[model samples]
Target: MYRLVLLVLLALPLAGCFAPRAEDTARNWRPMGANGLALGRLVALSPGVTRATWEAFAGIKGQTVVRLAAEYDPVRAAAGCPPPEAGMVRAARSFLIVDLAVTPQKSVDFIAAKAQAYSADGYFEEYDLDIGVIAALAARARPMPCADLALPGYLR
Candidate 1:
């Protein structure tokens, strides 16, 4: 009886390891804020693909965005993609504006294509609607608030 109880206790812990993981269910669902964007929308918007496929694509795109956002400096400098006249803060905000205007499929395609091109050439030189999307997102970014010296230290 003691041996059986011991075996059950050990198996109980291992059972969790065998239990299905969320990744197995929602493959493309990235934790939010990974790239300051929600990639699962791509799966939700796409037609014909199974949920699993869409989830996988979303995961891939999320990782791609994170990587690209991190490597943006090198690509921007190398490709001579116009120096952001408004600054990267504005450019980053521009992504929100661009997201509002484009369909998920289009956004996914744009990112995927750009990532592919970047992977091959170490730059993003091809111009398309995506360029306009980036510009718009930058243009629409909210400016930082002016500092108020009169305000209390915490409020300021």
Candidate 2:
């Protein structure tokens, strides 16, 4: 009887260990480490891949869902850390593109806030890097607050 009682106590703790923890719904960004940049590099390396094949290769059924967000390298820089290397910047940029593709509104909102904080320079840099973002905004009839200035012909 004592053995069974101890066994039951041990199993009870095991059961508690397997219990699900609460999900953090408020946090939208997820870190994917090096794995996060793989898809972007693949796309960059290979062009004209058929949608079906790409979809099959990147099927979500067995894959983990990762939502990329802006990197906090600035905070690290403030702490005396060196600026991110080219690969890290590429990963961050790729992640931002994925975020823009998957969640346009959220991405735009984030970009807009950044633009507001940093002024037209932020928008100009973002626009220069990715025209797709501006196109996405236009397609959705969303206002581009950062386009407040009369950009030169070169920028247009």
> Which residue runs does candidate 2 get wrong by more than 4 Å?
1-59, 71-153
As for candidate 1, its clashing pairs are 28-55, 94-137, 94-138
- For model 2, residues 1-156, the per-residue Cα lDDT tens digits are 999999998898677654322111112222233334333333222222112111111213332222323222222212333443333221111112222222211221122222111222332333322344334332332212223112333322
Structural similarity to truth (TM-score) of each candidate: 0.21, 0.17
* lDDT digits (tens) for residues 1-156 of candidate 1: 999999988898677755433323322333233553333443333222122222122344232221121112222212323443332211111111111212223232234212111222222222223433333222332111111001122211
The TM-score leader among the candidates is 1
The clash tally of candidate 1 reads 3
Candidate 2 residue pairs in backbone clash = none
Candidate 2 weakest ten by summed lDDT? 48-57
Instruction: State each model's CA lDDT, in order.
Output: 0.28, 0.27
The weakest ten consecutive residues by lDDT in model 1 span 142-151
